[model samples]
Target: MSAARGGLVATLAAVLLVTGAGCGGPDEPGGGTITLPPLPSTERTTAAAPAAAVYRLSGNLCEKADQTPFADLYPREDAKRLVATEKLCMTRRTSAEKSVSLTIDADLLPTEAAAKLFVETGRRLAKRPFTDVDGAGADAYWDGDQDDVKLTSYHGNLVLEVRAAVNVKDGMPDDVVQRLVRVAEGTYAKLAP
Candidate 1:
């Protein structure tokens, strides 16, 4: 072959070699021309799905609840109300002097998914003014309107609702809000822990 033709052939061979090397497969950024082999069946072809976290609460809602937080606030009188549809219980405490009452409702649902959805919906539907609560459960909010204030919390599969009602005619304490916050934190520690 002539010298010019030989030079062109050499350049073409070099380009073909580079292109072939690039076509081996893509794990490279821009991708590759050839398909990769399938991963072994015993080995995970792709990342396995993560397991759902297990959170469970068992037994009586009333008997197992912690109410010592209310010892200073009211006279302890616990209650249990089981409807055909759900498990509901309350610990009602009354302030002897101010005609104040606080009720803690621990409602256990069938699954964590349901309780989470309930709390999510409840938080969205809240129209009254409320404070966002942390460390109580998966999510919680405290709201007060007129004579009644409520703290709704969700943990595991349990939906906890704490309601406080005071008689405005009788009197209201200045530190009631702070005290309720303390009471809520104390109550959640016992229940969730």
Candidate 2:
């Protein structure tokens, strides 16, 4: 396939993998059971309270991501797409004419209860297929195809979605994608008690 065609296919797959309006809500479009791990003990503190509003920022959401992995991929100066209150952070790094890109979306909830509901909704989404990922967070799943990686994780009062697409013709590496997921999960885990 041409590079452009491959990139388009990869982008579509990433969109589908990261579906649910960035909420990863239960309304996943594909039909498959999503087995989610149990919420963390720290997340249960506010289970009895009413759900709080989901947090959405208007600035650079990528700033919340783990910088270690992305630091080299997207340099600070070149990756500074936006540094404001935007909820979506998308950027690409290019070298020798090859480029790799990523998009990160984080929804911070006002309460743990709200976070749980947000995550549970994604778990219940009968259409989206997700495999329960162990040792990642309170609940987590890794969704991917031939071209992209999308990891959805929830912990404490945070729900995070990490998506990456490398040079489409060359394809993205599994380890690279896993590292991004780790970054997303670890970053959110720190927010908990």
Candidate 3:
């Protein structure tokens, strides 16, 4: 072949090779290399129960008191001088069994006076007919109505009553309730004089 014809043929072959590689068609080896975009760094927050979810009265008192400092009433000195009594029972529910707990505290009051106060409170509670009284001490609970749990604590002359209702379905578990009871008792003990 002539030199000019040979050079032209070589140039044509190189062009075809370059075009085929750049096209990246399915027939081409390695096809098209794809690199995915990076994932997002922002975190997603899920809904959770409030820290004081077990305290039913917390919500109502927060609304009713409107930011009052209720903790001030249960001081350490008062708790030390206070005496506690409690009662416990089971509820009358057939489908789901429940436990009740009731506790009352009185400071500087005579034993008779304290007993009178507890009796009166129990009578009133019976009229309202809430949960059964389980046991008593510095803290107590009525574990009926799975959603609502009643709690009570006393220091000196101050009586703190809490009705914590589990607004969410399936509420808190027994272990959680037991933990909360311990926490409540500790808090009450801290209020001692």
Candidate 4:
């Protein structure tokens, strides 16, 4: 072997001896045990769950709302109206094809538990057929029977209502109902954040 290779082999042999490695014979050194460094782990790691979002109750729900979702259905916003100290905001938008109205009513209770109680009580008293909707807000529902699409949700101390005016139609179409759901979600973002 080259001088360099020979030197390397000699160094390795010395290290093996120091580390209690055997000389490859029945008569071995130490306990004839060899301990190698641990190999890299092959276990897969999974991502943790996302943190839940806490939505704030806005005083003026209309101002913080994102109207982009329903802009196509209702192109123009009606004349400005007075907002009740951010407690209530009624945003009315109209287009040649349809007119839509979204009402956000908020009641700031002293405590979050009180707010929840009030919302739950109101829901119970509604009596009307309500279909629970997912992800509209903390709690959400829609009218089971209606000529036009209407969706409602409660977040914190605020209740959001998205209503579409289609009185002439015999019943609400699927597209209209889906549109209302989207509108409710978009409006909830504004009113509850």
CA RMSD per model (angstroms): 18.7, 15.2, 28.3, 22.3
lDDT of 1 by residue, 3-66 (tens): 5575576667767766786764344322333333332342342459554334445565555555
**Per-residue lDDT for 1-193 in model 2, tens only?**
4555755766776666557445643445434343333333434543686443344444345555564565554454344653324456676655554555667777777876787788778756524466666555566776666667777777667677777776568667547656776777665543333
lDDT of 3 by residue, 1-193 (tens): 5555755766777666666556654542223333232332223123452332112121112113211111222212221212223311111111132222222222233343363476446534542333323323332434344555555544333344543333345353454344334534554443433
Which model scores highest in lDDT? 2
In terms of TM-score, which candidate is strongest? Answer: 2
Full candidate order by lDDT, most accurate first: 2, 1, 4, 3
Model 4: number of clashes? Answer: 2
Return the TM-score for candidate 3, rounded to 2 decimals: 0.32
Clash count (model 2, backbone only):
10
Q: What is the per-residue lDDT of model 4 for residues 1-193, given as tens digits with 9 covering 90 to 100?
A: 4555755766776687656555444442212444454322323113454444345663555676555666776789877844534566667677776566655455556545565676666555565645666766655666645555566666655556666554454334456656666766776565543
- In angstroms, the error of model 2 at 174 is 2.3
lDDT of each: 0.59, 0.61, 0.36, 0.58
lDDT of 1: 0.59
Candidate 4: regions farther than 4 A off: 1-59, 82-85, 169-173, 191-193
Model 4 weakest 10-residue run by lDDT: 37-46
The C-alpha local distance difference test score for the whole of candidate 4 amounts to 0.58
